[model samples]
Target chain A: MNTNTQTTRLYHTALSPYCRKVRLVLAEKKIEVELVEERYWEGPPDLKRRNPAGKLPVLRFRGNLLAESQAIVEYLDEAVPAPSLMPQQPLERHEVRRLCAWFDDKFQAEVTRPILNERVWKKITRSGYPDSRIVKDGLRAIKEHMDYLAGLLETRRWLAGNTLSLADFTAAAHFSCLDYISDVDWDRSEALRDWYATIKSRPAFRSVLADQVPGIHPAAHYAELDFG
Target chain B: MNTNTQTTRLYHTALSPYCRKVRLVLAEKKIEVELVEERYWEGPPDLKRRNPAGKLPVLRFRGNLLAESQAIVEYLDEAVPAPSLMPQQPLERHEVRRLCAWFDDKFQAEVTRPILNERVWKKITRSGYPDSRIVKDGLRAIKEHMDYLAGLLETRRWLAGNTLSLADFTAAAHFSCLDYISDVDWDRSEALRDWYATIKSRPAFRSVLADQVPGIHPAAHYAELDFG
Candidate 1:
């Protein structure tokens, strides 16, 4: 437990999209957070103490331990209202939440988890070698998602609406993780790539850009400002 | 779509916790909602028309379609402020959202899905007979969750805080699905049972209690107002 209660701290793992979402939100809010990498799978004794949910991306802010990525982000947006990630209208806000769930639940289950489990987690956890079949399936599944996202981007500037809302950050979080492993085919959708590049260049995205997981290397164009 | 554009309609499935959570919130807010049972697994083309996410619990309110259960519930609470399911304070609201995620994500993964997939979905989807191994594992998992929830009940009057909030509805949604198959050993934790009983007796819980899935019989005490 970092006794520096004065400073906002985040207990997280780099690969987790949930954690990344919160981190992006915190950074976008301009809150300087002390990042503490937790090997949560090791079942650290203090994990349950910090969060009963026993999950990653637990935020210690203003003397309270907050869990659940969406919950924490929503709280942060409400607590510190600057450069608002959420829109004003209720309907727009609903779209933002829905897209957030799209990445976290649907996209994660279909594309991210299977691909990450086979390619990333297997290597890191020393579980086994990547399953080509699963990776192939995830890659195939991602095309449909890319197409759907491309359709959305054709009409709107961001994932959910016009302005860069939480939806954009939520999507960028997932894509960034998949990008870390070079799973994303930027050539599939130029619109999707453009949207991602726009969000990726933000000052708030700097910390995430610097993430370097041991053993795994970033893609050649990952940190580059203009890969095109 | 139901031609009664004036009335709020929810396209949902009976056993989906996500749907039930929305139903409970709408009922709590005393909003008259027309429930449309959607067999989303069948993949009707119009499903995407109603909800691009193509999931259950798509709410049609104020002539606009809403997807994502949590988002819908939050919007309902915001649109109808009289019976607010969310707390005023950001911290308390965070706790509510966190617990909602606990049941929707963790508990559903640990208990509801495995057991239901074995005992319920197998029958509904005509997949196969109940897999005792999965059923046993899910049942075993429920004990720990019951204990944890019981511990929470000991300290607070409600799941997230002192008042009945979205967390309780989110939890009860999963619990009701488990209870339908007589899976929950209500005797495991007296406090959990008591907590459930109190919530179950509410007017808002009526529609859910009356849920009768075809070919799958409800437990004898499921609909009883004062079942011990």
Candidate 2:
């Protein structure tokens, strides 16, 4: 644990689940990095320069810039090589990566898309009139994802196997943000709910839970929930 | 090289770029596995059971199933640790993962969207008229992506770094599929063109080059090109 490097910097936002996944990875790895909040919606010149795609959670190390949350997390995992998020078995590792991609792709497209577009994106981008159709769809999609997640947790203590990996973090990050707005139906998914409680209670999760987004109030239920 | 136990099987499609990426990884890693061709477009019930999302390139090992090309490729690289696609350094590894995600997300959404939608998706889905606006935007976006890729390759022998990692395979897979339909402008991206030639000529790529979809004819230029 004595190998310390001060040059690691992470460009991220408090609300973005993707950013939070990278943050959780860094914390789990016990890596201290300078966290620079980037306003991706504003598309600032500096942010654009740092990431051509203007995405958040862009990690900079020694003059090299890396974009994409998946990439950043993998880099951190490989760099630290402790408390590994990846499994040792090839098939088990595939399961972890598959779930990670599922959250990034399927969940992002289905659940996060509609809700973020309605509640967060509209407020941030000043885009008027949250599409009711999309909001309805997002809400519906969350139920299906929850059912799928419940099934995964039925056999294992955590998603994508017993040990906590990036998959759990990625899923929790998205659900936590949605839960803040009372968008999550905890009663419908007891196993998944219990699993999240464990993750939310982790030392790495304290900062994320404490984060505040301006002008958007969290649901009352979010505060009362116990991690244990 | 004594650690060899093959419990691997790749679920893929001949024409899909994502499937091709996994195939390239398998070849690079010198891993042998059973290949099962899945028709995702008109998939059987079993395929959907294997992958609920009904996406192609699901890798199975010892009763466990893994979906998503990026995830499948990483699992392969880790499973067979020789001929590594990732760099030994943490920072460099991050660069590779970043580039791979870039192609999978931005490039797929922007460049592959139009061409695939217009040419492949249109024919495959047999849906209504192609959206002109989306197609136009995709064409414009491809130009920008090509330019960005050109700049990245200028400094290194490969996309992520000096070695041919999964990033190069991801890019080539997308470009190769697009090339089948003669969608890419080789003149606008001579550097990428040259790099692609090198990728196309690999022994692993032979299966992809030979792929053909029924009722759809490949462009004349595709057969003539030598990736070597």
- Best lDDT among the predictions, by candidate number: 1
* Candidate 2 per-residue C-alpha lDDT over A27-64 given as tens digits, one digit per residue, 9 for 90 to 100: 77777778878777787789878889878878776557
**DockQ by candidate, in order:** 0.85, 0.72
Q: Model 1 residue B21 lDDT? A: 94
Expressed as tens digits, the lDDT of each residue in A1-228 for candidate 1 is 568777799999998999999999999999999999998888889999999878988999998899999999999999998979999888888899999999889999999999988988888889999999999999999999999999999899888989888888889999999998888999988999888888999999999999999999988888886866
- Candidate 2 chain B worst ten-residue window by lDDT: B1-10
Each prediction's RMSD over C-alphas, in Å, is 1.3, 4.0
Question: Which pairs of residues clash in candidate 1, taking residues 3 or more apart in a chain or in different chains?
Answer: none
Q: Scoring only the second chain, what is candidate 1's TM-score?
A: 0.97
What lDDT would candidate 2 get against the real structure?
0.81
Regions of candidate 2 where Cα sits further than 4 Å from its true position: A1-8, A61-64, A225-228, B1-9, B29-36
Query: Largest DockQ belongs to which candidate?
Result: 1
